[model samples]
Target chain A: MKIGVIAYRGGNVRSICSALESLGVELLYTAEWEQLRGCAGLIFPGVGAALPAVQDLQRTCLWEKLPTWDRPFLGVCLGMQLLGKESEEGPAPGLGVFSYAVRPFREAPRVIHMGWNAVSPLMQDPLWYGIESPFYVYFVHGYRADVMDCTIAEAVYGERFSAAVRRENFWGVQFHPEKSGEVGFKVLQNFLSICKSYQP
Target chain B: MLAKRIIPCLDVHEGRVVKGIHFQGLREMGDPLSLGLRYEELGADELVYLDISASVEGRKTFLTAVERIASRLRIPFTVGGGVREVADIRALLEAGADKVSLNTAAILRPLLIEEGAALFGRQCIVLAIDVQKEAPALYRVYSHGGRIATDWEVVLWCKEGINRGAGEILLTAIGQDGTRSGFDVQLIRSITSWAKVPVIASGGAGALHHFLEVFREGGADAALAAGLFHEGVLTPYEVKLYLHQYQIPVRL
Candidate 1:
């Protein structure tokens, strides 16, 4: 399948892209998205801070494209936060696809929820694939999304927040599957299947 | 309850894992890949591979090495060294690196942070700052692999990294590196207080208590150690046990 990634500044999604390549995907970058029109899927991975990253998206007009993309979109970590109503970290606005608020972990074990934790699907979310029980995905973030709708998946950090959210064609994971090992790889594979069956 | 992260950094040069004091006293320790896998099994929350060597052509080799490691690693891994442009970030991600870290490149081209954050999402971009106590009262940011010192205040640049789309700030105390004493508490706290983003405290982790100290007094969201974890001085699992004793939340 043909896949596209947004490698803006230092995306470094080698862990994920390599996994997808192992599954026979032809990966393209943000600058090469034009050639991905007929591609099979799209993934938005994160690496660094938030405000400036969104600013660059606006600079390249991608800030507008995120909410409107028709392909099967998978957002990881900050990628998922961008789909929220807004982020408290900076002045940049979010894509606002999910009815959620992305805010920092105020009082928990502390900020920067880092490590592998149990993720339970609220129901049988498609991204869970065929996992037997709650799976563990690697997560590293200070801010998490608070969605009004029942969260698709949740991980107990200081408190429970949305670990993964879904509305129609959009899927967002707060953890790093590319880094999460087997369960994470399953997430990508599931996302690929979703894209394959997407009408849009 | 958010799980506090424990990270380990390995200095990879010429495709081998090396450690030293001040990031210069280079000594061959073990195979980078073997050490990387060991850390993952040891329950390291995340792993960072900093390429201290500044070879332009070796950039591809670095990516290849990271891919080799990522193929076996199921945890998050960040690679940094000579990453300079947006395309470099793309190549690294495509090669299987979970995250790409920018130190020299971000300092040289500050705008690259935005491009990286926006396209891939800010969480994948790491802004690693090398800091040194410039004066009795202030710590200054050092770039160009910590050789050239810019007037940029470490605290100020940390805030800039967040504004530019970096999700994590890796604060490495240049003077404290490999000292195993502990992290620069004052520097770590200064940036953590100003920036809401997650900060990884690096450098000067000599004893296991040093990790707890940085997490407590330094106000770091995460603690990263090298020599101690490398030389059998400390293990991530043992540190978690200690953090649990202190009532600091950690993944067991």
Candidate 2:
């Protein structure tokens, strides 16, 4: 099955595309929704600032078109932040696919949690199919999403925050699975499998 | 808890890994891609590639090498060397580098740090400082690959870089570099105390205990080594296992 990775500017498109390609999966990396029609899944991979990222999505018209899509979707790093309603990192509003709000890490010892951290799964999900709880995943962000109802996995820096969240077919993780090494590759592989089994 | 990072630095000159002593003497190691993949297999948390190529043709070759490494290597990697302008930073990032470190460029014109941060976010801009202890408690910043000493003090430059929007600091101690005795714990602690950004302690890593001291005593967010790892003295996995025994919280 082909996966559609949105090609917004300032995103970590090369890294994610390379990772997915290594799995021997077909991909359509584009900004146009027309090219994404036949894909089994869609991925929004981001790096860099939030305001510019959201603005790029809006420029590509994917900002409005993305939330309406029913296919299995995965968001990585800042892409996961964009899945929420709003973020404190910038003035731009998120896609609002989930009701969560992203805020800066006020209580953490350091602002940017840039390293590998253990992920504690809170609920059973296909994303964690083979991955065990307390699994180490790579992260590089200063802001975090709060532990909400849709949080499937939680991790603590200073306070517990949403590590992974799933609502219906939407799956988002604050960590960069593309850069998390072998275990992270497993998470992406699991995501592709989830997309394959998805009916809609 | 956030696990401390173990980064293996690869000095690439004309697409081949080279061993540089205090950023001077160069000796060939192996191919960049293979060595990088090996490190990833050996459980390296991240990788840093410093392109030491001087000629324009060499920089092109380094960029190609970076693309090859980025495609194969799964973990994040930072690329630095001769990054003077915003276009330079863009070229490295577009070539698939996760972060671009600025040393001489940022030191010469601090506006590049602010400009890079504005264009490509603060997270990708790393301020790399090479320091040499001048006095008992005073350290001076070095430029031109630790060859030229500058008047910029360590603590002031670090705070200025952070204020100018550098997200991370890659602090290398010139005196301890290539010596392999141990990291300059005093230098690392001095910057980490005032700087809020993640400080990567580099140079003077001899034994496994040195790594522990940098993390526990120096309060470093990450520790980097080149000659130690390139010489087959210690692997990243072995170091992490050693750190785990000390409750340092490594990703083993």
Candidate 3:
């Protein structure tokens, strides 16, 4: 099955493509809606601030189209933050695909909660398939999404925050699965399987 | 709680993993990709790939090797050496490097740090400072792979880099780089106390106690080593297990 990775400005498209390709999945790197329509699944990989990133999506007219897309969609890092109603990073409005707000960490020992940390599953879900609790994942971000009803996994640094949130066909993870070692690879594999079995 | 990081630094010259004593008398270890994979399997928290000859030879980083190795690993990989501009940083990130370390380039043009951090997030920009003691208890920053001394003081330069947009600092103690005596605990402690960003202590790791000392006494968020790991002196797994046994938080 083909997966279209949204070619948003300033995001690490190459690493995301490399990770997906390593899993034997074909990728379509494009911002054009027509090209994205041909893929069975979509991934919105991000790295930069919310203002310019959201502006880029709006410029390409992809922002308005995301909510209605009936496919398995995964958002990584900044992409996940953009799924929220808004972000404190830019105080910018996001896609509002999920009813939550992304806020910056206030009480962490370090502002950018980087390095390897453990994530616990909040409930039984396919994203946690074959994955044990307290698994290590790589996280690097100053902003975090609040724990909502859609949160499937949660992690605590200075305080509890949503690590992974799923709603219907949408999935958003705050960590970089591509860079989080063996267990991280398993997360990608699980996402691919979910996409393959997804019926639209 | 966040676990302390154990990083293995691989010095690569001409696509081969090499190690040197005080940045001289190079010896080949193995291929970069294989060594990196081995270290990851052996429980290295992170991997650093520095192109030792890139700046000296006035060439760009070996992106071909970096891309190949990065595609095969899941841990965060940092690539450094000969990174001079924002375009170079972009290219390295496109080649699958998770972070790009800036040393000489950042010293030459301090604005490069701001530009890089603006284009990509600050998380991907690592300011690598090579330092050596100039006088009694006075440390100075070195450029060109620790060959030339700069006017900037170590603490002042690190603070400036952070203020200008560097997310992390990879501080290398030139005096202790390959000596395997121990980390520059005084240097590390002072910097970690002042700098707002996370500090990865590099150079001078001999026994497992050095790792313990760096974390406990030195206050380093991570500890990096090369010579010992290259010469089969210590494995990443053994060091991490030792840290865990001593009640230090490390991913086992």
Candidate 4:
């Protein structure tokens, strides 16, 4: 599979790319968004605050290029938030792919929800194939991606919130597959498989 | 729900696991690789290894120990003590340590934290503070393994640490360390009150209830204990079960 991952500052996208390499997947760093000619899927991952990440994407022209790619796209954490209209973290508008806004935890417990979280999978699709129920995936974020109807799976942190979102040809997860253990590895592996066999 | 964390801290000296009181004595506890593997089976959420030895000569030694553990262990591990520059941080990463902690080196060079984060990413850098309460409501930062005093207050360094690219703050109250009395609740409340990153309250964790008090009452993100974990008085899996019974989130 030909996979393209967006490289944002402070992100371990490279690690995820490395892991993908183990699956015999071909990966490309599309930080500049100039070369997307033959990519099968795109993985968008970011660390740090929301506004600055969006600004960096805009500077690299990836902000404008990602949405219209007509290919499978995956966003991790801040990358998932950037798919929304606006995040409470800043002035930079989200990609507006998902009809939602990033909202801060009004009465949330910690600033960053580090460590692993219990993932309750949904049966809407088979993306979670071979993965066990009540799986644990690493999470680190303050603001969560609040979507209208795109949410597919949910994770409980203070309250049950959207953990993964799947739109037509677009999927975003609030956790880091690169840092998440074996289950995380599965998420990336499944995405590569989906991109390879995507009918659209 | 936000889960409470149980961390087993290993004090490394001359590239071996050692245990001591007030950061002295330094008797060999056990092999770090074995202890790390055992802690994982015990269901420890995380593991931390404090070099505890801050001498210039100690860095080379700890790297060998860290490299061995990182290759063998499957769980998350943090290595601290004597990490000075961005290159030092890189070396630790190359050695296979999951995270590199900064103490005296970070205080001496603040920008080194940002540089390390830029090089290795923020999630890999841990900023540790050794603090002692000299006056009421005032905890001063101590360098040289809690001996020398820096005018910077504990909270100040914590805020600075997160801003300068530290993902978590390993705050140990020297007054409460090794006492097995309990954590400094006020100190826990203060450090966790404003720190943006995850705060692992270390130094004094005598019982499971102590861990509970820190997280529930003190609002700490994680609780770490070296003596209790090493002595086998309190196991991480048992604590997780107890906390889960009380409606606290912990990995089970």
Per-model TM-score, in order, reads 0.70, 0.97, 0.95, 0.77
Q: After superposition, how far is residue A84 of candidate 4 from its true place, in Å?
A: 3.1
lDDT of 4 by residue, B100-192 (tens): 889998899899899987666677788989999988989999998888999899888888888888888888899899899999989889977
- How far residue B90's Cα lies from its native spot in candidate 1, in Å, is 2.6
How well is each residue in B193-238 modelled by candidate 1, as lDDT tens digits? Answer: 7675778898898887887888888888788888788888879989
DockQ for candidate 4, please give it: 0.18
**Candidate maximizing DockQ:** 2
Cα displacement (Å) at residue A117, model 2? 1.2
Give the range of the ten consecutive residues with the poorest summed lDDT in model 4 chain B: B67-76
Task: Sort all candidates by DockQ, best to worst.
Answer: 2, 3, 1, 4
- For A64-132, candidate 4 gives per-residue lDDT tens digits of 778887878888888888888888886569898888778866556655567778877664655687887
Model 2: CA > 4 A from native: B22-25
| Candidate 4 or 1, higher DockQ | 1
Q: Per-candidate DockQ versus the true complex? A: 0.30, 0.82, 0.71, 0.18
Best by TM-score: 2
Q: Could you give candidate 2's per-residue lDDT for residues A1-200 as a string of tens digits?
A: 89999888777689889999989889999999889867899998878889988887888768778998898999998899999999998866999999999999988887688889999999999899888678999998988999999999999998999999998989999999988998899999999998889986
What's the CA RMSD of model 2 in angstroms?
A: 1.3
Off by over 4 Å in 1: A1-136, A140-152, A156-160, A164-174, A181-200, B22-25
Q: Indicate the residue-level lDDT of A198 in model 1.
A: 79
Model 1 TM-score relative to the real fold:
0.70
The per-residue C-alpha lDDT of model 1 at residue A148 equals 52
Query: What is the number of backbone collisions in each predicted candidate, taken in the order shown?
Result: 38, 1, 1, 1
The docking category that best describes candidate 3 is medium
Per-residue lDDT over B78-157 for candidate 3, one digit per residue giving the tens place of the 0 to 100 score: 99988889988988888888899999999999999999998888888999999998776799999988999999999999
The candidate scoring highest on lDDT is 2
